[model samples]
Target: MKRLIVLLQVFLIGACLNKELTNDQELQKPIIQSPWVENPDEIGHDFYPRPQMKRANWENLNGFWDYAILPKGEKLPTLFDGQIRVPFAVESDLSGVLRKVGENQELWYRRSLSLNSLQDGKRFLLHFGGVDWESEVFVNGKSIGVHRGGYDPFSFDITPFIISDEDQELCIRVWDPSDQGPQPRGKQVNIPNSIWYTPVTGIWQTVWLEEVPEFYISSLKNTPDFDKKTIEVLAIISSESVADKVVVKALDEGMLVAETAVTPGEKAELKIQNPKQWSPKDPFLYDIEISLMQGDQELDKVYSYAALRKISQEVDENGIQRMMLNGEFLFQYGPLDQGWWPDGLYTAPNEEAMLFDILKTKEMGFNMIRKHVKVEPAQWYYHCDRLGMLVWQDMPNGDHGNVWEHRLGIVGKATDKQRSQESEQIYLNEWKAIIDANYNFPSIVVWVPFNEAWGQFNTKEVTEWTIDYDKTRLVNSASGGNFIMDGSKITGHMIDLHSYPEAVMPDPNIFGKDNILVLGEFGGLGLPIAGHTWQNEDNWGYQSFTDKEDLANRYKQLIDKLEELIQKGLSAAVYTQTTDVEIEVNGLMTYDRKVIKLDRDWLRSLHQKLYDLEIQINQ
Candidate 1:
């Protein structure tokens, strides 16, 4: 791990903390058998990981793996020092390796497993839920896979590398420089402070294996048409011969809606009448069962679902552009979700923990969450769908060059067009992968290309391409800063003009001209709980408050000001954050998912009023 140049006193303190980490050491002591804390009997974690696409046979390799940190350009470590859990980033407490693999270091992981259990005429596939920047994997020291991008899932067919009856060794290597590299890394820095946190390196997400047929469905893409009340389905197969005879079976409420077989590359359409629309209030999801067969012989099968919905911007009665969901204007009240956990960092400690954040937000009266910069696990979106939450997904930023803009407050200007182009291509590729991965989920309605000019460039092209890639969702060209007035909404950052417990509604007339008015950011309420912060003393937010009551009082006042703006033209707003992350102590919940800083009832009241305004505007 890369060492930080800290004061001698602070370095000694960190060394003491490292020595005091006993529970994690105990957790890592078991070698042959991992000391996994599988709280299956616990609430929330038992739900299936993926809701949109369901498969019956799969195993989660999330417990423990041998890990070691090496110096720059060092060969793979010869011996493992200890163990760390898969899926959880090194910076997270749950990983059992609470250290930073900064720009100058490398992380290595190795594990051995028997594949004999997967020998029932089933093919073996290796899957990575997500990795920070770059990763390379080898099975039995034979290179099998390489993947890039920090937020998209990728897989490799390891059938050739594995002898089904033998114990195969899996090895992985990763490198991430966080903010130092000109990559789409968001808010990660070696020197953590303020908005930035410690860099996450190596396998930060789930590393698992699945058993499937030789020729199986690789992915499913769904497009919904609210006007016709129909959905279009396109299933991609691994091979071409099986593609020509692809058959789709659509199911709703456990009943078959329609059955049709089409050529692999063509759109297979299914129609429904007066479909139950999906929203924060009524998140109705129709089930779908699909099977591909050739002459009565089942080749492959999978289960998925979709919802009929539309999101757009339209002129309201007062001649101001308003965000319309399902053809009616609605005021969107949500939180700025950073998607981090104290224990799991990038991965949640348990699945329920993931759902808890969304459900708690909804209970607090929010209908949406601006998934800031980071893309979450598929299960995260599934929870949002079932619990009734809206999402604005941001493409993870990379390729350097946005640091100056952030400091100078000159957002949305491209410094070097060359780097911007490279970053844009990478962004598009990952965005398409994310869109394709979650295309079936109905909760996500908007795509945010850039945030506050963090690696932002070519907004018009990126926004246009997003619309072309997925016509069903709205695209906010940029959020929290800058305006080219090209996309669907005119978003503004309204907070901390003087104090942290602050809020502002941008002049509706700016977006009332053509774009819908939206407060992309607001309400950075901060309260650092004792024993619940990454760094106790130096913890900071936009503004700091001493007590919960004071924070709540100021929050209510901010909401009241926002309410007045909604009466004028504001259509949507996002609170500062869903949970506190690293040194930024400005979240409704603490970093460890322990407590809610504000009274639940008080938070819910604010949301109830926001939703009520939405209904009124639509009427």
Candidate 2:
């Protein structure tokens, strides 16, 4: 306890001390925020964040927070400038304060929240859905914890630091060096331009506090066994003393569906009669009410949900390897979601804005989206499941690799081969961390090992390593370029031909081996809406258009081109992106997410056609 107090003190002070920032030149233009929409408190995220495991009483720490950005080498500000909604980056307009916290500065956030109904004797835990790069947390000036990874969720038990009062001051100091730092900072850079976007520093995810009982449920691991028609459930109980027995019950609308008894560290399989399968088209969720009992006495209880689905790779009728969703081949098509907003660099303006992207993608007749090189808040995946959208998740890339080594690929020029090895190890660790963090989402059907060879090294080993790590999902060994065919042929090496704008199917007769043909990325059509662009001079797209109508027509033509490719053997194709990022004006919508560049009806018509085409090929 004495050591813990000293450590907390050091952590609290450290958050204030760290200042690896850069010289800040004022941003050319400022971002804008959207008006707040009234939402229900009860069903706020009424849906479960984690499809695999969930809790009922868990509190969501999203709402407004007081923020201040002090220059590097400066002391903490005496007073905060204004309030900014958390889970959103400082540069994001939705955060209420659009400002830049360069590589050499520390961004500070302080919020005083009062807990209302934290039942007596319950242990309170503070949870941060995610924080960029490095973060240190403090409750009432007493340090609670510190975390390194920016994408994964971390929680600290604040029961010890609690002052026995309802009101508590939560302060967090964040430092993110974007691309300049060795951390897994994805495509973010200080100088925003084509392909790279504005830096997202500090808390870019939900920051909430939850009250749990002493010896409460920590994590729920749900694995679906398709062959056996069983769902393996493991409930990890957080306890001071060893748990003797635990009980789990699955229910739908108060009716008993399944129940099981188990010992700590043991998995319990719950079986049902003719379970309703879960898919993008039909996302059936089973409500679960888990109760941890000590000999018929309920000590702790929480509610959650899960879907029964499976993803795999298999040979199709045409003798081509295809992605199988629940034992059926389905051609996945959707936007390349970078998960950035004009207002919220890492966070969305609201939950509605998050849903709008996925819903619009589905509405436009695309069944899947490739979330490019960045992990999103759990709610993003939850929205995908609810709205019937397939997801291909990309592990965030870290460390600079050889640019010369990737000259032949779409990843642009990287750093160098020899230097990339050191980056390779860092990439592997961060990828593993990302995988472990997001492995629970049912929407994520495929894992992209390397994107166009950005910081890519030991391609064959990395591909095989990813496969070995999690064989449950399909693996895109390498998206485009560096066609050293290895790992699973799901991502048909960009061999047959390179540099094609439209969807290109893989050649099945390639050396007598079948591969899943997918256009990992293509169609970077640029349409910079007059006032919606990040920069006027540097803004550029793959194929620039003069007006919205021309942009829409060109987009439709590219997608129409997909219809022909779908017939040949294209399993999946990802449009360049969903919304404009920085100067890259290829998003289906404007950077603010206010303008749908394409006609809604026309997009939906295209979606129907694509879905019908995909189902027919499988049949």
Candidate 3:
């Protein structure tokens, strides 16, 4: 009996210690989470990152990765702290290791991937959809290469680094200074605040591997000429030997609508008879197939897509410069989408979560969305294209060395920040790459280069360059940015102004003839619902309200003012935001995407007024 009692005591002590350890582990976990935060799949972000350019066989390398955070100068740790979910930043809750990687620390990730037998002369490429600031990749302990620029997709040829058919080790080292550096990191910051939120370090997007032929098509540039009823495609091929020809095909619902053949590197014009125009009402997309052929044999084949659309600036019946879509003067209205998530900082929890925002924007009767300050995944744009939503994409801002003087009502000249040669080069390179990368999306109608003068520089020159680069789309060089003026002319396609709590527009009487007048940003109405906020203490908005009823009333009043401005000459308007982010509670939906602040039916009814006016005017 004494021995049995002693054994029971020991068992009880061990149980208590185990319980304490479990509690401590729970405490270390992330508190805030999204609705989709379940056990991660074997391959996270398994969906094809590039829908525009897709191949049949590719491996998703995005499940669990051994991670370690060490001092900036420290070598790679032999042992890892724990397993973290790939494609999620260290600071994000869904990463499984919600720890801050400070500016002084380097984040490392290690994993192993097994490969199947590959065809002879084929090359294997490791692709990263995006990584925060800087990344160095290694395969089988062999250094592959490094890539910078957080918002762009990059790939490296890993054929030479793959040493064995067995599991090969993959390692990545990342360093991100966030706001400390001069990189264009959007709204990421170390400390959370009213507007700025968490910093995303290391890989925050899909990592995959693709096997392709030695000679392959590198990229496709599709441009639709609405008047000519022809789609022009430029297939860029990378090959050591000259390819015989390139074949392009456009299909509608599986039937071939148009097909053409041209020289490998030249442009192929595929003529479509009675091409269905892509618009917010009827978003029609034609599936495309491109093949690189050597005489009678096909070397490589890729699947792509395109839409027939056009955007331009023209004088309407009211003698005002109006933004025209598909040769018609249509008013665009939507929310200013920041594209941040509570669970996933830069990435959405899943494709559904990403599509939810766009779907909700449409459900709320908004025809457009101004992607504010940040870029989203390629699939996000794909959703927009298919769902028939207009997009105005902003170039992520960086290098804030100049003071911005708001000249909302007054005629403001461009505030030129004399950026260093290096800073200017970085900005220019990234901006150009972003444009080139996203050029194929049909939903993007406008390219906003600067926002409210955040890192504004060389306004006139940049505006001209953008116009020259892609004449297919209109350029709002500075959306609510410092208006660059030449006497009476504000240089750019649009003249925009931002007002808080209520809607306002650029003075039509002053600059109505030359530029399209728009309310780039306005009506940041805030109502923080308890239990749905990022934090209870410091949650805020431009105009705070206690209840949903009061918030809706205030929003209705703002729309009434906006309707009055529409008659005065406003062509488009972007409401403050789509969802609450961090402490700023001005979103139509909560940060966790749990609640819609206002009644959707009522909001939609109110928004229909703007489109009704456009229809009446056109009639």
Ranking by TM-score, best first?
3, 1, 2
| Candidate 1 structure, TM-score to reference | 0.87
Which candidate, 1 or 2, has the higher TM-score? 1
Best by lDDT: 3
Q: Where does candidate 3 have its weakest 10-residue lDDT segment?
A: 19-28
Off by over 4 Å in 2: 1-60, 63-83, 113-121, 165-168, 240-242, 252-254, 404-426, 484-500, 511-514, 535-538, 614-619
- Cα error, residue 568 of model 3, in Å, equals 1.4
Q: Estimate each model's TM-score.
A: 0.87, 0.85, 0.93
Indicate the residue-level lDDT of 599 in model 2: 85
lDDT of 1: 0.72
Residue-level lDDT of model 1, residues 1-619, one tens digit each, is 2345457668888755753442123222211111123443331133455666667767666667899877667766679878977767877666777777666677888998676655554687788878888888888888777787888888988888886567999888887877767777777766556787656777776677777887788788888898888888888787765434667766777777777787766777888755788877788887776677777887788888888888876776777767888988778888899887655656666765777788888878888998988888888887787777899887777664543332111233434234555556777778788778777778999888777656666656666777787888877766753454344543322211112345555456544656665677776877898877776588877778989888888888888887887788777878888988877889998877677898888788766786676433434
Model 2, poorest ten-residue lDDT window?
Answer: 35-44
Considering only N, C-alpha and C atoms within 3 Å, which residue pairs clash in candidate 3?
Answer: none
Q: Write the per-residue lDDT of candidate 2 for residues 1-619, one digit (tens) a residue.
A: 9999999999767644532223333343443333232232321233344444555566677667787777654544558878877667777665666677877777888887776644566887787778887788878887677787778888898877766546878888787778777777778877654577778788877776677777888887766766576677787788653456777766655777888888876897878557877787798766666677777777777666666788876665666556678888777888889987665677765677677788877777778989988898887887776666788888776665545333322333333244344555667776787787676567788888666556656766777777787766777766664555444442332232223356555564652145566777788888888877765566878888878888777777877887887776677788887888777888888877767888878887876676577433233
Each model's lDDT comes to 0.72, 0.70, 0.85
Q: Give the Cα-based TM-score of candidate 3 against the true structure.
A: 0.93
Per-model tally of clashing residue pairs: 8, 20, 0
lDDT of 2 at 381: 81
